[model samples]
Target: MGKYTQDAQQLLRLIGGKENIAAVSHCVTRMRFVLNDPSKADVEAIEAMKVVKGSFTQAGQFQVIIGNAVADFYNDFVKVAGVEGVSKDAVKQAAKKNQNVLQKVIAALAEIFAPLIPAIMAAFVLVYLERFFRKISPQVISSVVVPFCSLVLAVMAAHFIVGPIGWKIGSAISSVVYAGITGSFKVVFGAIFGFVYAPLVITGLHHMSNAIDLQLIADYGGTMLWPMIALSNIAQGSAVMGMIILQKKNVAAQEVNVPAGISCYLGVTEPAIFGVNLKYGFPFICGMIGSAISAVVCVMTSTTANAVGVGGIPGILSIQPKYMGSFAICMVIAFVIPMTLTFIVGKKKLSMADRVGAGDSADTVDVSAEAGSISATENTETTELNGDGANTLRAFLTGKVIPLKEVNDGVFSEGVMGDGLAILPENDTLYAPCDGEVTVLMDESRHACGLTLENGMEILLHIGIDTVEMQGDGFEYLVSLNQKVKQGTPLVRFDREKIRTAGHPDVTVCIVTEEGNAKDFEFVTDIHAEAGKTEIVLFN
Candidate 1:
């Protein structure tokens, strides 16, 4: 209703208004409709949507591919059109009564627990083990024991529990697809989307693509729309990098390229396109090449997905398991080809900015501050503790203060480990709290990062609650382990939406791992603190 209002209105009108539709439903990457008169719909206008891979009428059903953000678009659609969503199977069983929520819940539960029932029943024979353990155990765990157990479990859960979940989800997501030109048609559509989507977005017509993807998923499982999105996104990002690669000495070009590249990676391409690439010339052409290559790869492999949220690296989750390999290959080609070609082609060349008048120049919206919230803290200096034997001095680590309990993870909430605080992050960027060497970087999932300060403090920055279950989808690590970083240095940038959509909280936990006495630490809590600037905890 908020952002997609106009888009929904435009799409409904293009599809011949709600009156032409007999029923409307959606799947992972598309919007599906049972239309009364398919001829009434403007096929030409519908095909023009940037997000739509293709459209087809099958069995009296008209479908539009929207991609991963289908869910969001569908949510907005039902509100605007008053057309309730049915199911993929709904058309087949239209005469039968719909399955109620309670029945569906019960059925789902049985499906999950049926295999475990035998093991659960067998455990009844071992009920005596519970009494045996209770009789043999010494009562009263010290405060230290509880905290130590918690720390171990948290790390173990994040390390072991998250990988299979993402894989399993990916396996399930294999049925999903992107919205735009799908199947064999994607090669053609991918190229068009990659080359033309930038212009469409500027004109505000790409919004219709979201609707197309919604129906694509509804009608044909998920769509390969994800890889198409990635191709287009990576092209934009790499092209921006390519354009400015040779302009390092030029302050104007560097200023545009650096920020544009970063934003492109985050799935926003306007800065790269309007601000630099389109304004220049070769960079935009390089982007088209990257897009075409990526699209061809996607079509060849027949990639598919459950949904494709906004594009970029984060959209990896929307991709299907079977096609992940091809998608990965596409990403490399998209990023590298354009970057390499543009850099080589524009070597030592003067910028195109000189040719255009200042009035016609695009003004860049300063967005780096929104990303760069980290800075060195005044409390970063180490202070001498009452040292009888300790070599480590107490130092302050800063960021937004948050309670571990609010983090929705049992390990931090119980304070089973040493406590610091967490941040309900305003942005996706994670920064270094102090001068340190990156000691532990959880590679499989980029949700958690750790640093060992020179003054002997080991800090853990855990992103999201239960995010390990997402494995490595939607996360990007900017710095690797053994790398030196200063206070406020950006260590990682992640897609917070990806975590939220996965049913996880985005509360980032900043932990001062308890190594010595717990009483020696005091942490700030329950406040909106700025990252890098606000002191989260001071070890006494």
Candidate 2:
């Protein structure tokens, strides 16, 4: 018998046996079941099982968390019940059959809106502001005055004034978009609109489409605009797939690329757009070109959607049955062209460094000689320094050393800010590379620090890629700004797990932001080094 056979038999019996289960599947940590009659399952008994950690019902599926052993448990459960397990997608499809009309609508809406939670969280800023106001108010009137003022300000700013202005602007834009998609030169306009739609999503203007789509449905019984939006999403997803092909060897790139691409194809494009395409530049343009071509085809065939359904390949379900054939052709164009163009362009233009989702060009930092002033010289030169005459720089963190060009950040990799070497750090603490006075410390983020060595070589030690967004949460400063420190002094201690959890690389970079009278420097790279002991760079 399998290790989980007995437990699986008990679970299966508690969940109403195979007779009640319509479908079953397992994700990384949970067993998902779609039941023919959910009421037959005993939730309390299932939760009390030794292998079960917790249980809950969401959408239409009953999920039982089994920590890391869900797959084994699911297999045994299926075997004991004399039933075959299904894929997650199959489970989802079966689950939906159990829901009523309202439940189905709610589930669909939840799926559509789940991707927007990050953006919606911006409203929490008002909650934080309210707390601040309460803290500052006198204790006697704090409760009444603070709540009253906050309520009035929030209501006035959001409901009475800003809300109306925003609605009018959105409506005006939506009207223009509505007219363009339905006008005489619609094919031409469709090409332009499809190309720009993804960028509109970036700027939050795409929300205006919901109003336009509903209005069009009310007036004309359908809207052609939504078909193009759906095609655009497929195009972006295709572009991300192409990137995946180009970056197959890069594990980090694949982690973001695969899921983001899948999400995009499923009608949520934010992950692909912000996480990969926009970060790299070319894929986004490639996707846009493909979208433009597909949109032209959509308009030529006069394809229209009954309403905005899933904005992807599944979107065909929402198209008028008569136009499905033509929309299928448009879908083919959307899928094939962007992927082809992205692979071709990425192969020629993207380096190994670029495929890893390099940091934005805007991340360039300028470092200068003055304390607290950050600026880099545009005309810096590189020359080799002989080992005999060189001043050594100790390793800042124990890790595998790599050339700056290999770093997954355009600003540091391309040497736009300064030439540097990066390390895939093995530890969380940063130590002084040499005896120097701290010249620059990022007050807000604390992800980077600058120092002027005793011999005047200005070095910038950056902790990780895009870690500035953490806002000093996982970082603790060991030495203050402008403090003179000897070699090997602990400079900054960071939480590497926190950095990784926040979706950023923990590569530490040591850059020569300014040469400071040193005519030449040599970088020692590719080998693992010990922090504060091994020499990684030399200056002369």
Candidate 3:
């Protein structure tokens, strides 16, 4: 079935061409649009459309309620109308700010963890279901259903958790893989050996079987698992540490070293997989060297079965106790060996001439240092305070109507811009857009604020989505009741970041009328506007 109808297209076209769209993204129920100019949008045309359940603009985003078929409509609209993708310049603009190594590492970890959320939720659900069934019928514990669910949960947890670790390990294997380590797939064999050495020898004897006494083996074997485990641990650690050294010395990108080191330290290995191997030349020799020694020793030690996997920290815990001593030895050696070799052999740093690829100007560097200057400029550019009086005719024709969603001056809703996940500005003062008299100021400044232009057109502006409880702590009113204000006068200045940190988007902008009863009115400015600008909105 077609996603959108001719009526929907007509409604969209009436707003403006695709160029008018600053950005477009959909939520569960609505197709959100950030417009170049809010005034240019044809809200009445949109409202009149049968397909459009309702329309409104908040946080600089125009939201059209399309119910369950939003996705289909969006797909058709983008394809047929040819709307460009979101601005990459914006993302680059955001990334220019300097972040410390730890912050970068945390950010990377957060990104890695985000994708696994759905899987985690699924696993947790399975766990809960299993528990619920077990509680209801203990005898059913061994039944197919119980074990089936338990296995489902376990497998999901292991796959989502261990897959990233394995990918990391695979990534670290690059540097050493091609170093003439002769033999049929010497790398794989070595890694397997290293894997066996840790769990079978170190863990089996020490941590796993500590509860069970195996006297015959104790008497016959001379703490066999210790050397193997030590060798494996050291090998794996060295492989990771070697990557870190190489990254510090060789990688072009800054701030990656910390994340690489942390990932290695946690033994997670995601940094290894997604980062190093993707860009650089192969360096798997370190992994083969580490894993090979561990593997050979395990084969020699007659290592049989493993209780756990070899990839991550959690998997390591499931290994037998007896082999733990060996695993520790392997880890220690692994860390020492690969790093020493990498330092001795690899290039430490690339020259500036080499670093600047594609003539992208080495001297240009990044201009994030000018952020404060830029911010000030942005504010100045976006502040709209011309000496001219209000457009009284547009204002009078703009019929006042109750907001579709409840809005309080102190409280605010997540507006339509972007995800609207951002918090609204609360502390700073809000200025009057044009020359106007305070005509309809609310009794509770927290609920709503209203102003009337000198030309006798009533316009209302609200503060927040739902922050009335705050009672204007971060916010301060600059103008008094019934005060006359010139154009561009600062009526209120709001503290945006504080309100955002408090868990609301700091987007506060002019809201014009939407009702059709008052016809012949037009909005003046673009929808997605700069921070402050003259003629923020025009009514004609």
Candidate 3 global CA lDDT score: 0.43
Two-way lDDT contest, 1 vs 3, winner: 1
| lDDT (Cα, tens digit) per residue for candidate 1, span 132-163 | 44455556754445445544554454346543
Worst 10 residues of 2 by lDDT: 380-389
Which residue pairs does candidate 2 place in steric collision? 366-374, 366-375, 367-375, 368-375
Clashes per model (N, Cα, C within 3 A): 44, 4, 106
- lDDT, residue 385, model 2: 22
TM-score of each: 0.33, 0.38, 0.26
Candidate 2 regions with alpha-carbon error over 4 angstroms = 1-179, 355-540
* lDDT score for candidate 2 against the true structure: 0.76
Order of models, best lDDT first: 2, 1, 3
| lDDT per model vs. reference | 0.60, 0.76, 0.43
Candidates 2 and 3, the one with greater TM-score: 2
Per residue, candidate 3 scores C-alpha lDDT tens digits across 304-363 of 224323343333453456656555554544566656654444333322111211101011
The best candidate by TM-score is: 2
When summed lDDT is taken over every stretch of 10 residues in candidate 3, the lowest stretch is: 357-366
